[model samples]
Target: MRQQMLNNGQQRIGKGLQLSFVLLISGALIVSSCAKIEPVVINEPAYLRVFNNLRFKVTVDNQDQTHSTLVMLINPEYDSNGIPAGAEIIGDFLVTRNSYAPPYPSHIGNSLDVYNPEYPGKERVNAGPILNGFDLSSWAQVPSGQHRVAFYSRPRSEVPFFNLEMRYRTEPIVDTVLDLRAGEVYTLHVLQKDFNTKENGILLRQENFHKLALADSLVYVNFYNMSAKGFFEAPHTVKPNSGNHLLGGLNLEYDWFQEGIREEMNVFYVAYDERFLRQHYDGTIKPLASFMTHLKRDTENPATAPYWSLPLFFNAQDSIRSFLFQEFFFSRPGFDATPESFMIPNDGPEGPGAGGYARLLCYGNGREEPPAPRRQNYVAVPNLIVTTHSGEHNPRSFATVNSIEIVNNSVYLTTVQRVYEPPVY
Candidate 1:
């Protein structure tokens, strides 16, 4: 009986140990399952604010000639299915062909659209309230980093076609990569290199839009060389003088040759001198001789008269203190004299004067004319556009800005209307 008790005690010990082992495993599993998984806190991604400075009128092949309008922007990122991320409608401006001018006709429309990636096909969300042109005042926040930018030209009627197939169906007329930084402002200028062809392009310019501590008595001016070919020739010197020449002709050779788009050249700081003010009023301060260029249309003649001078103007009204130099075309005449003129039937060639075709007129006589060549004279004219801010208390709140654009063979200045503000993304 004692031996049986010993065996029973041993069994009871064994059972206790087994029970402990099982309990230990069960406790471990319970701890593991009930343990809280700390929720992952993901920080919001940073963004880069980008502004569109592109403005153009597009003509669709199948669409009405009068209804020519096309402008589009696309984000080149792709999803799991390899579909285009989406597109943002920059501007669908209707071309008002009022007259046969070189610049063609100005565009007028405010409607812009952004494609809805979540909902594909025929669905879109308005980017913002209808903007007159590409919203230069506002910005679009894109995730900061490397991104591909694409531009397309299509009829306004086809904006509903937002699928990957449709987005790339026509091929992007302008495709480029942008290494965008967070919290920076960049202006993307899309220009129509050739209005007749679909060869469109983009030019990028960064700007500092911070408020300035500008003095009322002083004005600041900078030269944005849009005349790519015109600058090829050496510029003359101009200096300030007692005569009608406000700033005497300083050799601008160095100034003109300074290469790059929107390069930082000599920024003129003009004090409100009485003489300069008088010139502004009397319009006597024409471009100095040094500022003039004797551009030759015919390569044969080594000598030609300087017919055109870079157009310069200044405005000291209220908040805007600026000096503008408008050099929209090549100083050389007849290179691409208005496109409309080409379209118009050439009234027979080789006529000397009026009605009669002069051989020397159509084509140069291959002889260098004296100072101020007597060939057809073409002058650069200044076109001024005034805009007012509705809600601003400061009447002179307008700021100075500039841009370079290529439409066909013409290079002109595009006004940057607004500066980029913060809290965008």
Candidate 2:
């Protein structure tokens, strides 16, 4: 009986040992599987978009090279004091190069002539010229930090102007420093404040370029106010006139003061009305004749509507401490009398319009040509100062709104031009 009892105890101990071994092996397999699993990684890239809003027309006598500006993005090696040792050319873009005649206006021209350091005259491979008005579809990948930008103008050889050493001469324009963050997109607007002085300035604006999943009814618009003069010491406010009251009633989505760099206004709900009209030459008001008629919102095809609006209004202070709209007013006669004639139409769907996000820029500088009609009803619409006759780079004119198709979530630019005509009694 004792021997049997001892054998039973041994069997029970063997079963217990087997269960322990199984548990240990199971735990080891679980840890090994966990170690083999890898974490998923995602890469985000930095992007840059540049716009040559400068009015520097490079024409030789009668020749029109209005779009000969060359833009470059440089990444300089910093010294111990955090200063750049030498700028390394990273991006080269040629803007508004081709002849933009009537019918098909082309803003994409040639690439910048990048001479190789090792072999002069040999062009280096670079991301080509960005089309004027439109965003750089191809994002320029750059390091997330501060960077320097330079602008150059290619000499027009037609006038026998010869720079034996260099094909292009660098403009006196000041280099711009940008603080870029990883996974963010930036837009740099190179503007020439005064064509007479050839003064240059830059406006830097940042954007979130991440692809968004938005509802079908929704779209995004961004406004950039680049109309303010940078070189002039005097305030950029418009000269006091009664016309300023037109804009006083309308609330702007976003307005950038001369001191402000850039701002992203809140997203607006799509809305449009045909209540706007232009005054005819014969004391008649024509409905939907003005550029503001294009502000209508289309739901079935949002691309047919204006997504972004940039209304440039200058304010001048009166002795009475009141503000008035400087240049744009109502009661102007003749179709050509108002600066509205110079505005490029927003290409609608199936039309030449770029479609997605429509950018409308309304500009007027209080200057009107001789034979100016007397101001009546406290309404006056001044014509934009025509700095360049080339028609491509009108200093007073607004940038062309490229057609953008809203297949997915996208951003656009827009502006407003108000016209006041007496209501028919």
At residue 107, give the lDDT of candidate 1: 22
The residue-by-residue lDDT of candidate 1 on 142-239, one tens digit each, is: 45566566655444454433442444435555678767565445545444333234344555544443223432232122223322222222121111
lDDT of candidate 1 vs native? 0.30
lDDT of 2 by residue, 284-334 (tens): 432122332222222221112233432222223211111112222111122
Alpha-carbon error at 253 in model 1, in Å? 33
Candidate 1 regions exceeding 4 Å error are 1-73, 76-136, 156-158, 163-170, 192-200, 208-399, 404-412, 416-425
Candidate 2 regions off by >4 Å?
A: 1-44, 57-68, 76-87, 97-137, 156-172, 209-214, 219-225, 228-425
Worst 10 residues of 1 by lDDT: 356-365
For each candidate, the alpha-carbon lDDT, in order, equals: 0.30, 0.31
Question: What value does the lDDT take at residue 25 in candidate 2?
Answer: 61
